[model samples]
Target: MSNATNPTAEDAPPTTDEESVSVGTWLTVFGGVLGAFIAVLNIHITNASLKDIQGALSATLEEGSFISTAYLTAEVVIIPVTGWLAMVFGLRPYMLFNTVVFALTTLLCASAWSLESMLVFRTLAGLAGGTLIPLSFMLILTLLPPSKQAIGMGMFALTATQAPSIGPTLGGYLTEAFGWQSVFYLQIVPTGIMFLILFQGLKKTKPQLELLKNGDWFGILSMAVGLGAMIIVLEEGNRKDWLESDFILNGTLLAVTCLITFVVIELKRKDPFINLRLLARRNFLLSNLVGIILGLGLYGSVFIMPMFLAQIHGFNAMQIGLVMMWIGLPQLIVVPIVLRLMPHIDIRILLAFGAFIFGLSCLLNIHMTADYGHDHLIWPNIIRGLGMPFIMVPLNVIATAGLDKEDVGSASGLFNVLRNLGGAVGIAVLATFLSLRQQYHSSHIVENVSAYNPFTMERLQGFANHFGNLGADPILAQEQALRAIDAIARRESFIMAYNDCFYFMGAAFIVSLGFIALMKKPG
Candidate 1:
């Protein structure tokens, strides 16, 4: 039986029974899932390999972070344009083109010898990868009935929500066992298979040409520049010392001006790149607000945890990855259960409960010490795993619950763009916070020690003696003791910074709980 949504004039009449799905249908699902996974994974897998990439490319810490910031910055800029792009090119063709482009760029990234070359290709890859998330949702809405969308969306969430965490896990092992480049190479095989299946199994449908002709091209361009600039400022501001640098101050001002202008133009234009009318819906607007907060907490925590494990806990890349698997695995189990219970339960209550658990997880991190090990961090991650499905799946359902079919694409596009933007902001804010707190704590620790202080003298003498016993000269032992004291100060400073980050996350989660309370049940 054929499973076509649109029947042309020359098409054969349907049989008495509703059209049964063909083998091609399952093929399309697999293809779509694979494509979605590749797109999502690319955004995050490089995270664990950042240190290796930096060393290999001879890049500064700030320059190396661009590998992530550049990709996400490009992604947010493109996401809002997906609805208009789809209307111009159609779903099947657009997805196929994107898949091909992504594959080609991945190969380029793998072979890139210089940091500059890799950054260029990574941005290109991101432009293509950006469309997959929203388009995945659009396709699911088109193919499945509302009743079954929960399960299908749950499966998609496994890729979308879980990939950020899982990427580091897979990437850690690959980076440690092979090299950072291996992560890009691993995507080629899966994405190639997806391209073949999608090209074969999916039918093409052209978008309305009238809609394309009416789109505001200027608005789209402005929005892209505005968002891209804003993300750059956010990601790089701390490294440049924020407003102290002329570059950051000017970039921030330009971003704000352009973004505000884009909003005004879009609101006034007849056919904006993103349909602002969808935001008029209460649930749609509120759910997206929650999505932003969710992105902040989720990505912020994920971004910081690797630093904690590797720097403070002294774990290797592979060990960091294995520890993170404990978080991702439970989400897969929890998503299915949440899908089954969603219909019977109030989504707001579920979200609140999830926020509470998530906040509790953050609170756990606040108590972490310099002496804490892998076992000390495991339970909090597990609680985080349990809290995630409730926040993610339910909020998603609530976001699009009341939208008409025509609005689905725009709503999905807007929601995804905001989500990505939230993550970018979260990472930027946390990085800046971490840096400031580290310096503050380090200064405080240093001020508390003096040559005349008995405890300080005793510790320094003890360290000098320990070094002397290892066959060092007296002067060398004294210098070594100073170095040891400095190392201890830096370690304590990092611990304080991490604690501050966790406390901020907990507060964000509490704020989310308030927002969740405002969410009304789906009609």
Candidate 2:
């Protein structure tokens, strides 16, 4: 079946036993999946500990934010290029080197004395760790035959669906019990185990150094600059007031120009480093489209929940983590069932069903009240847990179904890139929206609660009398009454705004069903 006329196929590794893949191949895939899980887990691990880290480093909230931003920006920039680099250096040595770098950088992040030092170390770590995600994806598709792909997809699901859900939980617990630094140091044992497993499992292949000369250097530069700038704009844009701030304005312009240049370069080049043409395939493109919404809901929900608990219910990190576990833990049981169901199911139906349930979970949160607490959140989180595996596992199979071996690397890179991009965009939109809605709700409440309203006056006088009963001076009690009213208004406004955010995410997920309709059923 080997075709000498097809250079791409010729370059592909020799076909292995399709019916019975070796144990080593499974082990290699396991290592890759584990690496991907670690990479993704790191993204959210710092979230629960950001305040502690900020205090320790003597950094402001805005300055501390860069710790996450640095990692995300570098990760987004490096992902698309990973496939090409792996090809050039050979996957074994390339992955091992990056793993080592990732391990070292983990230590560096732990030992960082200042925000600047942390950002540098984080960026380096992101560059190294980013490779794991796409490479793991490429490994599953290239190594496993169709029959076993469901199992592979199930394992990969843990990384995509489970990792984000579990990250805050783990980090919160660790920070509470051990300290903020433990979150970084936590990776050490896993990294070592991962290194050893990968070392043994992966068969060595010669580096295709000749491929370097043909590398799409211009495209690479454009993509890196473009993606990096885009991430910065999204992460910092709201806080910096979008295009109003000079930094955000300039970053937006740079991102636009560079990304446009990248697209033009990619489309024109015959042997582009990463194949942009794979998007022309219907299933691949549609799967990616749905994936954007997936990321939006996934990351956006995770970001919003902790803030919701902290602001409304006054939950600490550990308490928030405990509640969040409803979203994370059930997947262990659910994904196996999903894997079993995959054979008999039409994956398109499964994917759509998953999307629907996930959206339903968000919609369930739309009625959140000031009193909404841990018990009220459980069903929605568990529903989300069920829905995620259905979405993630099927979507992976659909996207990669008809792809050729040579194209898997590029496809993997593009697939991962879009999901991360979606996450960035989602976080930005939700953050901005939350602020705007809060203002809107607060203004409406303020306008309605005027002296002209008897009910408002009654409530105000009641509060004043209550404070006066606590032995405050008459004037002081009146002032305290006004402050209390304002606080109530503010709290209620925030609750409404948060409800709006949940509704927005739910609508996004439901709307994504249209894209799923466009996808061809997996063969």
Local accuracy by lDDT, each model: 0.80, 0.88
Instruction: Write candidate 2's Cα lDDT for 124-221 as tens digits.
Output: 99999999999888778777788888899889888987778878889999998999999999997888888998888776777778777777899999
Residues 1-523, candidate 1, lDDT per residue (tens digit)? 0011221111111122233434555466567767777888997887778888888888888888898887878788888887667766667778889998888888898788888988999899999988777777666555555665666567776776688778888998898889888999999999889888877766766655665555687788789889989999988898899999999999999899889988888788665667777778887888888888778888898888888988987888788877777778889789988988888888788878888888889889997888777788888999988998888877777887866666667777888888878888988899999998999998899898889889999999999999999999999999999999889888989988999999998898898877777777888
Misplaced by over 4 Å in model 1 are: 1-30, 54-62, 207-212
Q: Report clashes for each candidate as comma-separated counts.
A: 0, 0
What global local distance difference test value does model 2 have?
0.88
Looking at model 1, report the run of 10 residues with the lowest lDDT sum.
1-10
Using all chains and alpha carbons, the TM-scores for the candidates as numbered come to 0.92, 0.97
List of clashing residue pairs for candidate 1: none
Model 1 vs. true fold: TM: 0.92
